[model samples]
Target chain A: MAFTKGAGPHQRGLTIGVDIGGTKVAAGVVTPAGRVLARVRTETPHKSKSPKVVEDTIAGVVEELRRDYTVGAVGVGAAGFVDDQRATVLFAPHLAWRNEPLRDALKARLDLPVVVENDANAAAWAEMCAGAGRNADDVIVVNLGTGIGGAVVIGGVLRRGRHGLGGEFGHMTIVPDGHRCECGNRGCWEQYASGNALTREARELTQAESPVARGLAQAVGGDPALITGPLVTELAQKGDRACAELLEDAGTWLGIGLANLAAAFDPELFIIGGGVSEAGDLLLEPARKAFRRTLTGRGYRPEAEIVAAALGNEAGLIGAADLARDALPRWRQGRRQRRLSRSRESRRAF
Target chain B: MAFTKGAGPHQRGLTIGVDIGGTKVAAGVVTPAGRVLARVRTETPHKSKSPKVVEDTIAGVVEELRRDYTVGAVGVGAAGFVDDQRATVLFAPHLAWRNEPLRDALKARLDLPVVVENDANAAAWAEMCAGAGRNADDVIVVNLGTGIGGAVVIGGVLRRGRHGLGGEFGHMTIVPDGHRCECGNRGCWEQYASGNALTREARELTQAESPVARGLAQAVGGDPALITGPLVTELAQKGDRACAELLEDAGTWLGIGLANLAAAFDPELFIIGGGVSEAGDLLLEPARKAFRRTLTGRGYRPEAEIVAAALGNEAGLIGAADLARDALPRWRQGRRQRRLSRSRESRRAF
Candidate 1:
């Protein structure tokens, strides 16, 4: 009802989408059809960061992107809880935001309507509309990078539950007291299934007093600290049995986590993104097998299809842009039209 | 849009929703606004050697309900895998159905259209339309009884994914190598948090080796087998320290599972339904604490409001009736109107 129906496609200026991550901040201008028109990026500072500085950094990126396109509004996809109004970052584990008034602050600086969303939600939206999940209606997008991140899209809309913490798939305890997670919990899903976990396991396995350590030892030299997730991927891809086993271990744990996700949210497709996903089937083949085996009532259930993301690193950029486009006044008009249709269906049911 | 939206409230023609459980088969008629009409229940046949008899028995219940109302379509919510078309029971552990064409078989006997869905999805739908979630536009309904079940609805529509095998929340693993689950998986969410686990722990605690179990041992007459989920509920309510601890333990596990769900679906509301919910805060208070404690980046996110289901056992009836109300020929009037509006939205969005 608040939307204007049939507002033409280019009725207003474009908005900017800013993706704030632990390592970097990316910004982009997106079109209504979900295409990113322009983009810019800047690395995040390591120590003694101020809120004003972060805002300025993000604003600077937006200015660069905005120069090419007349920006109307802005959307920020932060790696933390976004308030219900999509205005504030209540807290961010890896960032400087602590009960920060992110939207208003950014709006004050940029003079635009800034809608903030969870980063996982933004990535999932990108995959659904223009990435790996182009045609799938129900999908769970898992980002397997430093720590595991997740977002669920059910019937074409992001599911950002009551508290905005709906996609914290990494924290689901997979062990009662397995590993000490950065979140101060034991046996959280991320502690075992994430890139950090994988790298840690690789280092441990290579240093083990067993025959499996030999090949890994030769690959990474004598330095256990030298092992990394990419080296393990290289080892596995090079057909190293030891590295393959390590990946299988990670994959098994990954599958175990995914099965839990399957049981919790039965989406049709699972889009695996992030750095670890680049290992492709080496990680996924075992994950697929383990997912099938771990799923509840295995023989009695229809399994969800697991796939890799197509958008790669661009997902965040594209996702942010798409979110920005949707915030534009013209898109609001179109959304109103969709809402009208939903209400029409509602009326008929009544 | 096969449903006829404009049917009268008291119309004789109705739809049947059948909930297939390990213990019983319950069938009822539902109204569009999520009201259950007449209901009938029959004991689930023992794990007999014959599969046809079970279906025959279910058909008998449907037939009896049909005799009372002008039942138009039939919906079966089986506790196992429903195939892609929602036509056949691909597999069921409790029931003997392997590639069973449930829809056609039932349709053949009743001469009606039949749609089969996952029991979890159906139950979730029941809550969404008639139970605790009647007002939510987006909801994640989790059933925490003997086993956990899940259903996700966005914008008031239940999401069934690619096939109907969506919303299997119990199998989502909260712990890695935590406990062996009946699903042949290690450490499924249900392994630690369900009524089964609750009662199991209660029995183990009250065994001969433990002095702390004196309170429960005195009540159950040393018969460990008598420790039912409800008995535990009663003991927990009466301030039995051992039993209270047991419920708290289950609640913590439930919280862990729910946190995972929150991370995945981000539902506006979480409706906790099922038999185990009868214990009220004895279970929920701990769950809330644990959810807050374990949620990733706690205090940095929006959280789902966990509430007990209001509709109770009659949910399936109401949800099924509401679903079928649209499937009938007469409801086609509503479909026609909705299509017009939807097309208009598509036109506008483009």
Candidate 2:
């Protein structure tokens, strides 16, 4: 096995990064540290949705960017799960792929190296590398979009868990017998904290003609259907009572869920991202207050800072590229086979 | 800082282990691989009454055991919340130790190398070293005793959270508006799946004169006060319907709780210990079944093995001593005051 040296003036000054979203395929040429040198995007074709075409689209984007900048190995970050090998998109919810050999196929077709990874994991890494989580050894990312997303990095190494299916922060059971979750569970943390859930709560409040809904009703033209996550965040920023309450509710739930996560995984910082986080202090102020209130041993331990994600939408691409740059010898997401050491004990404390 | 080597020929013969329980203190000389050599027991004395007298009583038991065997370093597992320094007991519900420097105090008094640890973490380490969790890198210990005790081991090392409060599994809310817990939280995991809960449910069944409570009432002589976690387990083993049903209910909840932990930490093995674990397969069978049913990704990943714990009562002492054998470096648990490494740029993954 050969190891490629990272970030040297040896060859090119650019690395190819691919961000495979639910609706579009975006690719960019990233600098050694993390700046986007050049970007190219294309509509994700809706053909047989042949996994082949998806690979081709990624190659096409990289190919176009390479024409403008000298690109090295490629990194692709997709919405669904990526296998441990860091070269396969094992399953994608919005994309048509099942146990698909993405990186290997791309490597074979393009004669260039490639790696694939989960979008959230990639995004978190990007934040750590050059964004909000920089200089932190332990960091957590909570993406509050359509659904909530979570990722953890401990001692600077991303904890991929036993299987790639490790960091499902959205699915944590927060409310018992409260709301039915999509994953066949009841009252998941996401059901109470995600952007979709925020909209749901806002709609309910508007339908009931609550006292705080007047400002929100004026913005949405008296239609409850107009109350979306983005609109609510907009109204909250403008100091609408109903919108502020919805954001506060989201923040409180987010805080409690985060505290629970902190109890399990002792992270030092949390980077909040996604569409819902655009309200900034409107969402963050309540999140910070409630996190302290619900935290175990509240005043004892050093608290994890809850901050906004710095890299914004570009994290997934950068993280994917970085993951590819450091693929393990036998790396498969769930099947990370380590040489089982028989207790060669060390007093390595944490 | 000096560290002890892994158990080799040196610790093969015998090492004294001490468990400071709520009601009693148990001590014994144990072999490296986990067999008790010479054992002694005494009632756990109250400190308010006479803290020095209680210390003297502990010393008497230690001296009694020392007379029969060549013991190595001593390990004491206390039932309480330990501090990050590992030398102090912050707060113990059953014992009178508030910010008390336990290890150093005991070491000075006993004139023996002493190590002190939280009882649950110690029990977990004992299980990993000599019991059900052998050869596992990540493990979770669920002790279903009076309340609930939890311990998490990641990469074969005990994961002490930011405040030395990593495994507070018992306190996580399983139900938002359920029963009130002793910790001032409602519907904690302990409230539904522990020895106390088991006994409560069994006693209720017997009092209700239900079909499953027939054997339980007979065993307890139709007296509700006679019902206990152990008696219920015993009756369940004897094929009693009501008692068995109660254990099964508790075990199913245990499985659900275990599943939640598994989802959060992604451990490869779960070792179930404590007094209630004595119910054996009568409880474990149901727990295993429920865990499989409720696990997040049922058919996606490798299922974690749920098994019984080893070391029995002496596990806590053995594990604590073993932890002491490998001394904790002060820096491991503290924030490093160092800047970014000069070699970090070179170590970057492009």
Candidate 3:
């Protein structure tokens, strides 16, 4: 609350960062160094499921944290497509944000400058600025949550493509006719490599009463529906062979997906984040092996290093705050120009 | 050779561009407007199977074109990876050049500033500057020849990633275990969607003696091994049903690969060039269809236009020349700094 460790009077002011997911709203007052000074969390209020309700929930969290610190700006990392200007949410699958003007609404309600970004992009920027990708000029972040999301950082700048919809790596087809995806595409990379893929595969194995999943089924109380990604990860961490094998299978697919990304981006490093990445080498080793095998020009070209995310779950909030803080100077420059132009109008009237 | 019509005297001097493939060497004297002032072609001297033999052939073509035009610089677009400095050929699959210092060799041999570039990159740049992607801020070029090759142009500059290898779209895996690729990967997009794929499919049909391939086999004089990509293209152009269907299938795969690229890059336009691209609408319509169907966030996001290359084969040569001409200023800057540093060294000696 008192600015993590040290806060001199001359120090730069803090900014609030909000990570809005489907189930939770995690907000924090972040320092310029990406330290979370104070934080508040709340259920997403999905029962209301309205844009106003969501904004009010986010505002409530900001209000609680701002009381403990002097804040400069607010940045929200939303699980949706943010406009090129970072002013609106084009669409979010779990939120009632269909082309919602969330930024303007929040700015008006809180009387603070606001900037919004795609959640994955915010996380990637956080890694580049403060986490594993620090000092790396070109990096790609593949966040393997229930779905796979990605962000590209080139020359240390976040690349939001032509329409602010670049990093949708999960949906890239990996097995042309392989598995059906919620995105309505068949054989999406996420369908085979993400947390959902692991849970689905495990669930199917248990449902079919496969011998390999005997221990997993027992841990899930004999209910195939009770199987979850985290349960499988926990089981794998505890040295469960079936769960480990499942992770390895998913890891192989993940590696192939990474190879495809490498073919296009040729980044120096890849940062793996999201929920499933918690499996660690249990998931990455197989991926790396497959990547080496599948990478084009395997022996000739340099391969990108694949590593886990350093900021963990806090990356989104931290990145959001920093992005807002970075945009502050430009926003102020714009305000000054408007004020100067207004004064010129007044002088002309005189 | 004279400048193209309307090129004023104050315009930049012409430069020579050479497109060196495994089988042919195409060279041109190009003006600042991306117009070819003069051109010459010769068979590649792969009989000697030496890098120097290839260089001498390139030099022979450049020397021939230079005699007719007053050139400023020379640019060679080789079918390989060009280093970040644009001064070395890191590796070429077709030519016997592995980490060859072709630029310095050419500069020494010709006494002119020389720049080497990846052929796909050169073609993409040409399209951006003068062809299909003219005035477009962001563009992706997919060249579907013997295999697929790609380049990304963001803003106005070509993007060469961390190690000067970014746009090898042909190698991106579209199907997990669909087909074996020459790069040793299975189910690469090129394996399913390139000219080789088309020719292979047609050849297979003829080899198996399918009734649909009757016309194609007859066109190839009943020799399945005689089937080439152009032969299939020509048959399709003449309204051959089986040949048309093969192109359509390959186009669909091409479209899927393009969708994967869109997910990563989000370029505003995609220019499809290369030898197989000559199939025109016969190839593009199906690709566009598959692209629309497989594209992530299909209805919500703006789709990139997939079109044909207007400059055709000359794009490589013209773009190479333009790249060399552009590098001339920077090359001169380095020389000037060297001269100034040498003077300071003499001063230190005194």
Among all candidates shown, the one with the greatest lDDT:
3
TM-score per candidate: 0.84, 0.85, 0.92
Cα lDDT, all candidates: 0.73, 0.72, 0.84
Cα shift from native, residue A8, model 2 (Å): 11
Question: What local lDDT does model 3 show for residue A149?
Answer: 93
Instruction: List, residue by residue over A1-350, the lDDT tens digit for candidate 2.
Output: 01234533233435677888877777776654676656677897674588878877887887787676655578888876565566666667677887888878888887767777778888887887778877675677888877777677655666666555556677777776668776677777889989889999998888898877887777788898988898888887777877888899989888888877776666778899877888788889899997887665565456788999987777777777655555423232212111111111211334
TM-score-better candidate, 1 vs 2 = 2
- Model 1, B248-311: lDDT tens per residue? 9999888877776666666667788888888899999999998888766665555678898887
Residues B217-335, candidate 2, lDDT per residue (tens digit)?
Answer: 88778898888898888877877777778888988888877777766666678899999899988889999998887676556556788888876777787676455444434332122
What tens-digit string does per-residue lDDT give for candidate 3 at A1-350?
23555653234657889999879889988777777777899988774467888988999999998776777899999998887778889888888888899889999999999989999999988888778887576789999998999898765557788778889999998887889998888999999999999999999999989898999999988999999999999999999899999999999999999998888888889999999999999999999999999888877788899999999898999889888875577543211112223323432111
Q: Show the colliding residue pairs in model 3.
A: none
Candidate 2 deviant stretches above 4 angstroms = A1-14, A42-48, A209-211, A298-303, A328-347, B1-14, B47-60, B68-72, B207-214, B328-350
Model 3's alpha-carbon lDDT is 0.84
* Residue pairs that clash (backbone atoms under 3 angstroms), model 2: A83-A333, A84-A332, A84-A333, A85-A331, A85-A332, B212-B242
Candidate 3 structure, TM-score to reference? 0.92
Q: What fraction of the genuine interface contacts, i.e. the true contacts, does candidate 2 reproduce?
A: 0.34
Q: Which residue ranges in model 1 land beyond 4 Å of their true spot?
A: A1-17, A28-39, A68-74, A111-113, A203-227, A235-243, A329-350, B1-15, B29-37, B49-51, B66-73, B206-209, B215-221, B329-350
